[model samples]
Every structure is written in structure tokens, then in C-alpha cells.
Target chain A: MLDAFGQPQSLVVLGGTSDIAGEVVRTLAQRRCRTVVLAGRDRDGLDRSADAARAAGAERVVTVVFDASDVGGAARAVDDCFDAAGSVDMVLLAVGMLSHQRDELDVERTREIVSTTYAWPAGALTRVAARMSEQGYGRIVVLSSVAAVRVRRANFVYASAKAGLDAFSIGLGEALRGSGVAVQIVRPGFVRSKMTAGLPDAPLATTPEAVARAIAAGLESGAPVVWVPGVLRWVFGVLRLVPQALWRRLPG
Target chain B: MPERTLLCGWGRTAPTRACVLAPEVADDVQRALAHADARGTVARGLGRSYGDAAQCAGGVVLDMRSLAGIGDVDQVTGEVDVGAGASLDSLVRATLPSGWFLPVTPGTRQVTVGGAIAADVHGKNHHVDGSFAQHVAGMTLATPTGLRRIGPSSDPELFWATAGGMGLTGVVTEARVQMLRVETDQMLVDTDRFVDLDGVMAAMEHGDADYRYSVAWVDCTAALGARRSGHTGRAVLTRARHAARDDLPPPDRHRAPSPPPSTWLRAPRRVPPHLLHTLSIAAFNEAWYRRAPRHRTTELQSMWRFFHPLDGVADWNHLYGPRGFLQYQFAVGPGEGAVVAAVISELADRRIPSFLAVLKRFGPSAPGPLSFPVPGWTLALDMPIGPPALRACLDGLDEAVAAAGGRVYLAKDARLRPELLDTMYPRIGELRTVRRRVDPEGVLRSDLSRRLGLDRGLDRGLDRGLDRVGD
Candidate 1:
């Protein structure tokens, strides 16, 4: 169960291989989170994250195979993960594939990015929300991006997919208001991780650890949406109002 | 299916949704218990608990107020059978006119009889009369298995467990309580003002035994703006005894015992959020402390004025505003009064403003494993819930409290961590054993029980087993 501080004692990380997700698991483990269920596609990466959690004071660590490419299998994978660890107090959704930057949209690349960033995640989250509502109490933290606030010209496909995910998460939270289940969305500007290894750093770029801290704070405060560095909350407020003519000229 | 209702404790924090069913009869309670799902069912009364003790998320909450009925008081024995839903206000009104009063009334007379027993509430006179359960002779409890009439002699384990068990034992349908006989509705109260924590502590230790009721109001905000002496625990102490018929003024000598008075004022339903910050609370504290007479003896005051001062202001908790407040009350053993002092100093140093801080000396604890009070000092403070430092500050205090062999009162607690539950209540295993006996299927649970991990021993043990596997 989550304590009054909103710290969960047991949690499931859907994208366990994601750097931000791994850091969150380790941080929570140190904060007394005992049981960890890490589900991702990479076998070796899942093992590494599980070991990190175990060393960080998690008493029980379980790993499950989950493939974002197989959107149809999302619900089944989530069920297996929850069944492997009964009575989970929290679930962190942190799966995404940053498509290679290109001037012209490739039909297949757009499809892959949308599937990984939006469709599969939304499917898995819907299943998790249903299970959590039945359990009577749980917290769901989804790692979105500042790009979701307003899709950029350079990475429109990835940003637009995130925009869809961000909307879905907010809507789901409102739907589960009285179910003793809460959903929190984390929007980080530019996080340094494996997925963005070679990308040019965006303004207000942050690290995985910083994003983890923001998630912890957001969960504690029961905030519906949290922005990394916090300033981005205002930064995006202004960015969203910029005229289309001016926005198009801004560099990525 | 009944529509879910959002419920919060008196402090109005951590609200949860539950299917609240008003049970008019014992049969209704039994039916609800039998039909309870895995999320579980618990009983609720006037909801005076400061936290989640009465709330069960996504489960059934049997509203026992429908069964409220006060039986005739035994003229000679002073024992009255009361339905769990009956409020102390109603009980006092029924019996006080006949020269009898509730033996243990909390600061508010609004709590139901079941809530009083479930929380085993104590009042200014706890040092003399013990908690509410001490005065209860017997009660009928509705469990998932069946209904049972239990007392100190018949099913002593269940009886004691039901007391201060936070309703996890079962839903108390009715109880026979032993009220105290009094001469009048007035009290002869003595008031004293102290400039430091040590002065009041010494006074209470030596003088509390001489009075039937005693309590001290410490100015926590005063501690923040410490005087040159660096004394942070300035306080106003009041001790009282029932005013005999002859003690009253000439014209009122022949007056009959009256019921406790009703509220004279009510806080508005809505107020601006974060209205009671440090500046405002500090000013209020200063005015309150200065208003009390330095030393006054045998001042005749009404029962309501003397015992339930806050009750005179209806919904006074609303003054804390939309975000609500947290009442942190904890008790420590004798010779550990320094822990109380340390906590006051810590709050002062951290600049965390507390509006009302009450200090009292407690008598020996009751038999209930989870009963909060012991033979020692207990302090309760009310703080609005917004400070970023508040959580960690209170966490540090919890560690101090556990180390000092003390425990936070579950009824008023909203944020106590689970790891220290054993250290705080060593006999919790006994509670779990009795609970497993009465509710083996775990059909009885509350948000407090779940948050504190009070109802999941087997699951916790399984985690320990997994720990072994990992090793």
C-alpha cells in the first residue's frame, strides 16, 4: 500500500529498460519500495534494472517480457506482470522510441513511432488502470515529454504521438477519480537517456535522475501534471501562445 | 449497487470513496458484512476521527447512525445501554439532566458512541477515569462470522481488541456504558499560566493527581518567537472538578443539571484556502495566551465551556480551509516528557506553525493492544497541510517517538509510517490473531488498516519469503 506520503511499497515498471524508469525504480527502492516488477523487451536490460533495484534495497524483484511492437499483446503482458506481483501499489509507464530526425515523414517510421510511443502504451495503461481500480488503490506515473504540450517542427511524428498519449493519460486520470486510483503525468523537456543518446540537447535539458526526482515529488503532492525543472510549466505556457508564423521560425 | 460516497475524517484529509450503507438494524450490519467483497467493509459513526480510521476505499462503510437509540439510565447503577450510532451529545443530554455524565468525553461531544469506543477516546479526566472503553461494561459486535455479545469476562480477548481496535474487530451495534454521577452541570475550574515547558510539566506531574480533570494549552507559535529565556513552551493550564450544588452562585444554587449547550457559532462552509498560515496562527496564539488569567481558582464554568470548548464552535475544523489540516497526537511514557519538549522545540526551530497544541498526563493504559495512551505525557498539535518541510519534520519526530517507547494515536494520525507499527504497538500480533479469528477471510478493513499494513500479515510474510529467495 502507498503510505500517506504517497510512497508505494511495491511497484511495477512497464518500461523497465528505459533509463528514467530504471532510475525511478532504484529511487523508490531506496525510499522503502520492497517489491519490484520490471517488464520490458530487452532481457539483459531488464536483468540489469532488476539488479539495481535489488541492490537499492528492494527485497523482491521480478522480470517479465513485454514488446511495444506487439500492440495486440499489451493487455496480456500487463496482466502477466500484475499477476506475477500481487497488490502492486504503483505502476510507471516509460516506454518510447524516438524516431530518427528526417525532413520528410517516412510512412513506416511514423507508424513504428506511433505504435511504440502511443498505441501500445495506451493499451497497457488501460489494462493497468482497470486492474488497479479493482485493487482499490494505486498510483500510475506516465513519463511524457514537454514536446507533448506542443509538437515541434523537427520531430512532429514523435511529438504528436506523445501529444495523443498525454491527452489519454489526463483523460484516464479524470475517469478514475473516485476509484482510489490516481494518474500522474511527468513532462520532461529533454532527458539524457539511451533513446536520445545522440540528439542535440534541447533548452532546459535534464538527466534521468532529475526526472525521477520530479516524479517522486509529483506523486507525493498528488499533482495531475508535473514539468521537469518546473520552469517549463511557464515556458510552455508562453510557447503555446506564440503565433504560428513565429513558431515555425524557432530552431529545434 | 449503492452510489459511492467520498468520506474523510474530521481533519478532512485523504478523502476516499466508499459504498456507504446506513444500517438500521443488527441484521442489516450482518448482511452487509456477509456480502462484503475482498476490498472489505468497516463501520463508521460521526466521523470524528482525525484521519482515515473510518474510511474504507472501494468497500462498504456501514453507517451505524441509523441505529442510534439511548436506553434508560439505571438510576442506581448509572449504567445506560446505547446504540453505537448515538452521539455523546445525545447521551449527555439524556443523562446529564439526571445528574450523570459521560465518564470519558473527548474534546468534542459530537462523536458517536461506537466511534468513542472504537477510538477509545480520552478527555481532560483520562488520568482519573481512563479511556472510554474502561467505562464500557459490554457491547454487541457484528462480525463476518456472526453477531456476538462480548464483555471483559465473556470473550475478554475480543472485548479488549474491539476497544481501540479502530473498528477492525467488528461493527459495534450497542454498548452498556457506566456514566459518572455529578451534582451540577457546572465545573469549578482552576487556571494557571506558565512561561516555560518545565514549569508546566512539573506542575502537572505534582498537581494533576489533586484534580479530577486537567489539561494544558501550549502555545506552539510562541515557541517560534522565543523570548530571551529561550523558553518555547509557554502554556495555560486548567484543572477542574464538578461544581457541587452549593458551589454555585446564590440564585443558581437551586438550578437543575442542564444538558451541554449547543454551538454558539459555526464556521462558514467554505473559506479561502491556506487561511491559517504562520502569521495568523501566531497572532491567534498570542491573543489566546494573553487572555487567560495568570492564576484563577474555583471559577464556575458550564460543562460545555469547561469540557468541550471547541464543540461550542460548530465545524471549527473548516477554519483550516480547503487543503485541510493534520492533527498529530502522540503519547510517551513517564520520564520521557523530554521527547515532548524536544518535539515542541523541533517544531519551533523548523518554523512550522501549530494553531492548537494540547498537553495532558495520561493514566495507565487499557487492555486493548492498539489503545494509544499509557501512563505518561501526551501532546496533540494541529497544523495545516502545506509546508514542504512538514513531512520530513514529522517523520523525524516519529523516529524520536518510537525510540522513546511512545506511539502516535491512530485515531488522529494521517501520516505514520508502517515500519514502526511494531515498535509503537508491540501487542499488534495479538490484535492480528483476534482479527484473524473473527475475520479470517479479511472481510473487515479500513484505509488506516491498509495504509499501516495492519490487515496483511500473510502478504508481508510472503514478501519476507521472497526476500529469502532473492538472497
Candidate 2:
């Protein structure tokens, strides 16, 4: 819950080890956010995030094992996180995998990328949204990418998965309207996080802290959509209208 | 179930989103409290508080308005059991025909019964009748432990703790309060203008006791020329009392006394931000001071005109524009009245525009530990927020007030420092002990509580001993 200053008391980060998620949790903790639940696949990584949050003034830090690829077990993972924390004021869905487009020619690799990026997260967030609705209030912040705006050939498989996740999150937000739950879709141009480490810097590359700040401001203002390096919203608006041939020729 | 929504106080500043649930009954409130998340829960009434007292931020806010249900008034005792959510406006409308009125009403009647009690609001009649809590007989509170009935006699400690407790103790569900009987709905007013702050203070000190209600509007922006003639901080003082039937027109005298219309006018949808700048406010103050009669008496005035003039202008807060404004109100004992003068002069020296500055005299303090009123002089002013020096000026005022053994009204505070809580309310430790008994886990909290460190744990051994003795 957030106090009158828009400071949340407890937060549940699904991809706790992700750089963006860590930054968001750290920022909130500094504002007197007391409880933090970190859920991720790596115990050591989750411990590191929890330590950082505690140092940032979090009173309690709990870590739960979460594997985004375990589609069938996603709901249980969410339930475990909530059960450990009691009631979570916010849930950040920050799990994503940027698979190499060349490896995506293999059907298994494509399925893995799509499932990890979209199917699993979509299922987990749907269950979390239901709990939030039952609890009467919760903010679900989904970290989508600007890649969802247009699927470039260089990273077509990853972009397509992001597009699907983005559509699903937006639709879920609409469904949860008036049910006391809010969904904030974050589309960052290119955040320099571990997932995007090996990739070349994009035109409007941003840092994890910048994306975290955007999320914080978005939550404060109750903005439904947030564009990190906010000019991306307008740039994408124009790029989407470009001719198909010209759009295809543009490199990543 | 609660829904995420933006909540702000009357000041319309620093809005925060929260999960708000409008609980229609005591049971609903209890259920909501039970299920409140880690951020805890706080009860909110009409949102009339000028600051963060009602906002819980990220926590569940129980909007008590849905619980509004006014029971029948006890004609013999003039006592009524009103739901915590019931607004004073509705109470006035319901009781006026029966020749009864709220014992105390603040500048506005939009406040809820719970809010009136939690804030222990004082009115123009404070010098004569005291504050709202004095007339409260008893109340039912939904505590984290359970629902409990408390009163001055039944449980003096807990009752006083909850009174002006800022909803930190628990949620008040219903209260039995005594109302004053009135002969007519009108007031026979006496208006007088003073050339300077000293003149007004002397007049009020000498004559205010003659009337049941008195207030003075001071102009803090007057120039040095006015001061040279002993006319600095010129003021208009109004004193009034409920009119007798004979005081009304013959036609109105024969009819039953009725409450006035809720609102007579509304402000425009939007007011330009610059409309309330120093120049405009200064002009308004000058005109307002000059317009009042030099001296007049036996003027019949409607309740709306006499009691709540600003209520007529709906969304009047928007006049301050998007940044909103702050209302800084402080009270110092009668001996320290000089502090009031110093503050007004400070504002004038800084050229900080205050559209409305009111000065009043309070008779005595309520028993509530955190209650604002004392036998003192209180000054309240409204100033826009953008001034760079406003924060420092207020901080300086806080120090001056503390040094003078005065305190700012928590109901109107948004920026008070935490360390000054002990200085402002010396008995806060007692309130904390009582709170531990009812809400040991601190499930009931608000943004104001966190900001002031009001929820910090006390000596555990002492608290446990108190709890055991009570049990």
C-alpha cells in the first residue's frame, strides 16, 4: 500500500534480479517502503536484490523462487509470493529474454523465447490481477519494450513476443478497470540492462534507473502508458506510419 | 472491496492514490479493517481536512461517508446519535426545524461527524462554548481489537485519545452528541472595524465575552502609511448570537426555523493562477476591511452569511490553481498573543500574499491530548504554494510557536516536522499508550501518522503494564 505521499509499503517484484526491477524496488524502499518480496529463478541473484533493498531502508525482504518459463506453475509462484508478503501493494512483471534472431530459426529456441517472454508472464499476471481485484487495490507494472511497436527483421521473434505480451497486458488492464486494480504498461526504447547487454545501443538507449524513474512517476500520476525516453511514443507514432518497404529496410 | 483512486484534502495539494472502500455499515468497516493490507487502513470522512490526515497512501482508506445514518434526535436531552459519516450540513438540516443546532461548527458545515470529533474542531463560539468534543456524549469505535463503546465517563483515557486523535486510534462509527437549542435560525450580528491589530485585540479581549460567537478578519498586507497612523493590520470584527423570534421579520417570526440552502453560488470551473497574487489579495483585503461598518449592531443575518460565507463558492480551492495552496493556522496562549502579531508582520515583511487571515479567541482547551484549542489567540491564513521562501517561513513560525508554547492545528497541517510533535502536544505519550491497547499492531494509520512518526513504538514494558491493568 502507498501512503498519502504515493509511497508503497510493500512490493512484489516477479523478476526481482532484473536490473530494472531492482532499481524500481530500490527507489520505493528509499521512500520508506517497508516490505519487499523478490521472486526469481536465481537464489543468489534474488539475495543480492534483497540485500540492496534492505540497505535502501526496506524493513523486511523475502525472496521466492520463480521461473518464468514454468508456464503451468506461474500462478502458484505468484500465490507463493503474495502469501509470503501478506498483501502486495505493487507487482512488477519484469521478466524478459532477448534471444538471438539467428538462433530463432530453430523451432525449440523460438518456442522458448516466445514462452518465456509472453505466454508465461501473461498467465502469471492474469492470476496476480485476479488476486489484486479480490484485494480491492493493487498496481501491476508490466515492463514491455518499444520493440512491440514494430517487429524489425533483426529481432523479429523477440519483437513479436513482446508485441503479444504488450497486447495481453493492455487488454488485461481494460478488463480490470473499476475492479480496483491498475495496469501500467512501460515501453522503453532500449534499456541498458543485462538482457540488452550484448545488443548494440539503439538510437534512444536509456538506463535502468531512467526506466525506473518513469515507472515511479507513472504510478504516481496513474498514467496508463509510460514511454521511457518519452520521445519514443512520438517517434513510434511516426515510424508506424512509414511505408512497409522503408520500415523493413531500417536496421536495428 | 476498495478501488484505486486519488485522494486529497480540502487544500487540494499533494494528492496520493489509495485503495478506497466506502463501507456502508459498521460490519463492512470491520471487514475492511481486517483485510487491510500491510500499508494499514485509515478512516476518511468528507475529506474536509486540509492535509494528509485522511490519506493512507497505498493503504486501504475506508471512506466513511457511506455509513451516514442520522438517528432520531432525543428531544428532551437534545442528544442525537449520528453516524460518523454524516456531514454537519445534513445534521443542521435535520435538526434546525426542531429548534436545535450543532453545538460547535467550524468555518464550513461540510465536515463529517467523525471528522468533527477526530479533529475536535473549534468554531467562532470557541471562546464561549468550547469545541465539538465537549458536547460529545459517547461514541462507538471500530478498533483493530474490536468494536468498543467509549465516552468521557466510560473510558476517559481512550475517549480523549480518540478525540482529535486524527483517526490514528481507530475509526469512529457513531457518536451521541448534545446539540444547542435555538429560538431562530438567524443571528443578530454586531460588526466593527479596527484601525490596527492592537485595536481589534483590545476590543475582542474586552467585549467578545458578551456574545456567543466572535471573529476578526485582519488585513496583513497594509502598507507602512497605514501603520504610521496606527492602522497596520486593519481588521473587521463580527460578533453574533442566535436571534430571538422577535428579532426576525413578523412574517418569518411565525414560521418554524429552518436551515439555509446548502450553497447560494458556485465559482467558475477554473480560475487563473495569477488571480490570487499579492496585488489581488491585497486589494481584496483593503476593500473587505473598508466595506465593513465602522460600528453596527442588531443586524439580522442568515446562517450561511454569518457562519460559512466561503461555502457558497463551490470548488473555491481551485482559485489557487493547480499548485493549490496551504492554510497555516497556529494558536498561542493569551499571554503570548505577541507571537500572532509577529507572524502577521513576518508574512507582511516577506510580501507573502494571504487572501484570508482570521483571528479568534478560544476559552479553554479540550481534554483530548492532541486537541488544538487552548485558552489562546489563534490566527489562520491561506497562502499560495509556489513562493520559494514559504517552507522556511513556516518552519520559522513553527519554532516561534513552539517557543511560545503554542501549537499548529494538525487538521490543517501538511508540512509540520516530526520532532515538534512532542512540543506541540505534550500529552501525546498518553495517547500512544491508549492506542497500543486498541491497535497493538498499528493496523490503523495515516500519512500524517508516518510523517510525524506518531506510530513509533513506546516503552514495551510500560505499554504492557497499561494493557494488563485495562484488561
Candidate 3:
């Protein structure tokens, strides 16, 4: 215990109030983490998230809500947000959006989905990873989609977007393997989140609570990849055998 | 070395909770050198040095006092090899019976030989022996290359560089430092009093050269017409050393007896200064100066009692009454003697009154790049922190000092801005260049480095919108 030590130990969380990010904030409290700033757009949501994080455990939690949509050269703003974070340890990017199956069919809609799902998280996490690596140790979590494994016509746009993300996640994990960090890729089949509240349930659906639990477990174990339903790894293995034409007819 | 950790009653020099390291023998010191991974490391015996000189912020501070196995002593030549971590008082206690003594002892004997060499400490006798560094004939300072032995002649540059390098150059282990053959464990003394600021400066310059030891005490109360020679100076010059039979100098004067980290703060808390005013300060000063032994010549006095008279009180820094105090010590070189007089007169004019004013003559510059000594006169005074006015006064003084080509001591600094440091020490870049060469990755970092902008690495935003002003 560093109770006898006088100086404070600093920490930075990248994903600004991401559920898993929030949990990490709570976790480091036992180690006496002094500074925690959650960055995201939803001030109300982040405030609630930080409150929940503090309630769980955190010494000093802060909020720096940001819009990662790159509205006006968003990369510059994201970079600026990082400078404000000051010596960040982990950047939990929980800013991704999920598009409905029908609306994502439009090219314009698909582009938005692709950027938010894959491009924004990828660009930001890479920067965060590079910084943490230089500091000697870093922890990052890139939430990927299991729909990416075998795309069906019912959800091709969403699956296609996640496909790009899944590839980037794996590559980042490999790149950061020995960089004093263990990048954890969480593939939860379906999480009943605020976005999916009125939507129909999918197979092996996990509650946000369950997803948070699996991610916390994976991060602590330094696991390379985590499948939320536990059986999806095998189910996806079998789904690979399905022909594309037949797979197109199945309900997502 | 004592078996307990000590702090001054004010927690300065008294042992508090002592710890004993497993016998650190030859192998321990050698292995420690290999184990340490930093830009540079310094051995710390007792953490008694006035400033961060003993505190390695981002670097390692090897506790040399832990290696306390005494070796054989040469009675004829008065040659002895002591552990680096061993305390000065312990060394003195062992050598005194044999009529041998450390040639130079600073204000406190609690400091380690390793620390003394690292800081190049000087005592009242500095006008004679120079400093502890001059007495060190040979040293075993660990470096990246290996533990190499060095003397004044063998690579003299590196030796002197390490002498006052504040442990930035390398880690000092055991040293073959020179010692003085003494008549006894006593110091013969004389006292001279000066009525005014000019009188004090003249007295020190005219008479200090004739004696082996010299120092003065001045009253700080800004009382009109009631202070020391209006800023009095008390000087002592000791030439004869006491015989071997004199009682051992009281155990390390600076040692803290308990855990009183903020005695300065605690006392002020108890007796808040809401009642203290200018008149009160004047009354206190008058009482203090009246008690001094004026125009007295002592037949004999212990070296510790004579030079470090204040050490007996422990944590005397607390008497400043808690908002804490700033010990502003600056010396004016030959060309800038007028700068010294100007500063003193300015302080007097403002009625800021110094409770502790000391004047000393610096003989020569040390080898370290940033060591704070120049040939001329230096003055130090303790000011009880007050308000915005205090900041203004210091700012004004800083400008005057800079104009006079004078510099501030890094060890005692509390509120210097990053920009001023660059101007004060033009050679700061040279030290930074040496730092870069030693550890290019910039792993050796501290709050001081960040505050002072030491490694102003490429701003990450330069590639993007570095143009944004406070965006």
C-alpha cells in the first residue's frame, strides 16, 4: 500500500466515461489513482457515468466531454482534447454508434456508420496507445462486433463497418503486444444498451452489466480477445461454413 | 551512525525512527552501482543538506550511511577510511581521540562525507581550507563506465566537476578525504562588532584574512535606529584548534529529535500572527541583539558550539512564525559591491527589517556548472512571508540582482518563474546538454524540470494546430 507515500499517482482514461473506461477508473481507486477525466459529448451521460464510477471507487473524477465526429477538422479537436487530459494512462473510446439495419442501406448513412464505428475509434486509440507506450505501460480496449465474422444480408452494412474495425483491432493488438500493454478486444454478440432499448433482441444478448463484467475480467487477465456470450467463439466458428447466399436470408 | 532515524526537535537534526540496513560491504556498494538506473545517482547519508542538493528528485539517492563498517585507522598519518553513509559527527567522534579532524565542517555535522563532497560544503573556515571538496584527495564515484578511482591529478576536471556538482555528475561512495591534525577538540575564538552595514563589510574584509574562521550574526527587525549598527554584523575568527581531550562536540547539532516536518507551519498555527505587527518585530529584534556577546574574546569553544551556535535550538526556522519564511541569500561580486549595499538599503528603506542577516565573502568559483559562489561579498536574510507586497519586493530585488549580474541559489528557491531561470544562468543550457548526453531519452525528469521547462520537447501540437492560443 502506498498510504505512506506523500505524492499522488496520476492517471488518464482515454474513452471519457466509456462503460469499461468508467470501470477502469473505479478499479484504479484501490491503487490511489488521483486524476480521472472522462471525455465524450454527452455531458449529462458522462456526469452520470463519472458519478457511477466514483460511487464504485475513484478519488478525483473529472469530465471533458468531446464530440469525436470531426465536424470541423475533428482530428485537431481530438488531439487538443488529449492535451487537456494531461499524461493519460488509458483512453477508453466508447464513442461508437450502431445504425439500424434498414437506414444503414443508404450510402450516406453507411459512411457515417463506418466513420464513427471504425475510423474515429481507430484514429484516437492509436494516438492514445502511442502515448501510453512511451510512458512504459498502457491499457486499451477496442470494442468490436461479432457480426463482423460472417455477414448476412439482414445486417451487411453494420457487419461490413464492424469488419473494418475488427481488422484494425487485431492489428493494433499485435502492434502493441510487447509495448508494456495488453490491448483487449471485446466482442460482445449483442449488448442491450441505451441505443438498443426498443430494438428486437438478438441471440446470446448480454446486458450492459454483463458486458461490463466480461470486459473488466478480460482487462485484469490481460486477455487478448474476449467474446461476451462465451459460446460465440464456437458459434462463429461454425457460421464460417455457411454459404454467402444462404447466410443472406437469416435474421440478424 | 546511530541505529535510529532522527529529525530535529523542530525535526531538523534529531533521530526519529532509525533503520539499519543489512551490513553494506564492498559487494553491496558495487552491486548498488549496477542496480541503479537513472541519469545519475548520488549517495545520501543523513538528509541534512539545506536544499534539494541531497534530494535526487527523479534520480536515485543511495543511503551511504548504511554502509557503516569502520575500517583500520592509521594513527601516525591520521588516515582512516569510513563508510560513505557514516555521519560527520560519528567520523569526528572516532577521529578526535587520535588528534585528527575533518579539515572543514559546515553548519551541521549530521551531513555525510558523500553529501559534503556532493554539495562541496563550506564551513566558517572556508576562507582557509576552501571546502570539503578540496580535502577529498581520492574518491570512488560510480559512473556509467564503472567505479573508477579519481584524485585531483587523475582527470582533475572530472574530479572538481563532481566536487560541487551536486551529485549530478556521479554517485560518491567511500572517499580518501583529507583531515586536519588538531591540538584539541576545541576552537579558539575572537569577536568583533560593527555598528552599521558598511562597518560589517569593512570588518570582514580587513580582519577575516588573518583568522582561520569567520562568520557574523545580524538583527532583522526593521526597527528605525534600533537595529545592529543599523544592520549590525558580529564576526568570529578562530585560529587555534583545541587539544584532543576537549569533550566531543555535542552530537550533530542539526539532527531532528522527532517528526516535525512542518514545525514552521505548526508553530504559526498555534500563535497566529494576527497580533504581530511592526512594533512587535522591533521589540523582538532589540531584545535579540542586546543578548549577543558583544566585543567578547573567548579563550576556547567547541567547533560545533562556536560556528553553529543556533544548532542547539533545533528547528529555529520555525521562529519566523508560520506563513513560513524565505531565506534570501545573495552575494555581490567585486564589481557589484554597490549592488549589495543598494539591496540592503532598499530593504531598510521599505522597513521590511530582516530578523536574520548574515554577510560572508566568497573567495572563488567552484567547478560545477551552476554552483553559486563568486569572489565578492554575499548576504543572507530571513523574511517572514507576508502579503502581495513581499512578492513585489522580491520581484524588484530580482531585477536589481540580474542587472548586477548576480544569480540566485537553486537550493533555496521557492517561487522563481521558468523564464527568469534561463536569464539568471546563461549556462543552464550547458547543464541541459550534459543531461541529454547522459540520458538522451529524457528519462530523468522531475517537477522542477517541467516547471523550469528543461526538456521542452517538440510540442505535439506543432504538427497540427499549434497556432491555437489558449484554445
**How many angstroms is residue A51 displaced in model 1 relative to the true structure, after the best TM-score fit?**
2.2
In candidate 1, list every pair of residues with a backbone clash.
none
What docking grade does candidate 2 earn?
Answer: incorrect
Q: How do the predictions measure up, each by TM-score?
A: 0.94, 0.72, 0.55
* TM-score sort, best first: 1, 2, 3
Query: Which lDDT tens digits does candidate 1 get at residues B1-471?
Result: 478887888888767777899999989999999988766789999988998899886678899998899999999999999999999999999998888998998988999999999998999999998999999999999998899999989999999999999999899999999999998989999999999889999999999999999999998874445533464689999999999999988898887898876789999989987788988988888888889999999999989888888888889889988667889999999899999999998898888989879999999999999888899999999998777788789989999999999999999988787788999999999899998888878888888887788976734322222121111
Per-model interface RMSD values are 6.7, 10.2, 15.9
Q: Across residues A158-197, which tens digit of lDDT does each residue of candidate 2 receive?
A: 8899999999999999998765578999999988888888
Residues B1-471 of candidate 3: C-alpha lDDT, one tens digit per residue: 224221211112111121223326545655654654432234556655433343322234456667654455577766677666676777777776666677788766767787777667776666665777777778776654456687788866667766655565556667875677765556567766555656667777787787777776655455656543454333222333342333334553223222112112222334554234456766666665665556666456666666555555544555544344555777567667777777767776677756556666777766555556667766676565553355457667877877777776554443344456666766665555554444343333322333344445423211122112123
Q: Report the lDDT of model 1 for residue A64.
A: 97
Candidate 1 residue runs with Cα over 4 Å from true position: B222-231, B458-471
Model 3: residues >4 Å from true position, as ranges?
A1-252, B1-43, B56-61, B68-79, B223-284, B315-324, B350-353, B418-471
Please state the CAPRI-style docking class of candidate 3: incorrect
DockQ of each: 0.36, 0.06, 0.02
User: Number of the top candidate by DockQ?
Assistant: 1
Candidate 1: share of reference interface contacts reproduced:
0.24
- Model 2 pairs in collision: A1-B58, A2-B57, A2-B58, A3-B57, A4-B57
Ranking by DockQ: 1, 2, 3
lDDT of 2: 0.84
User: Model 3 lDDT vs. the true structure?
Assistant: 0.57
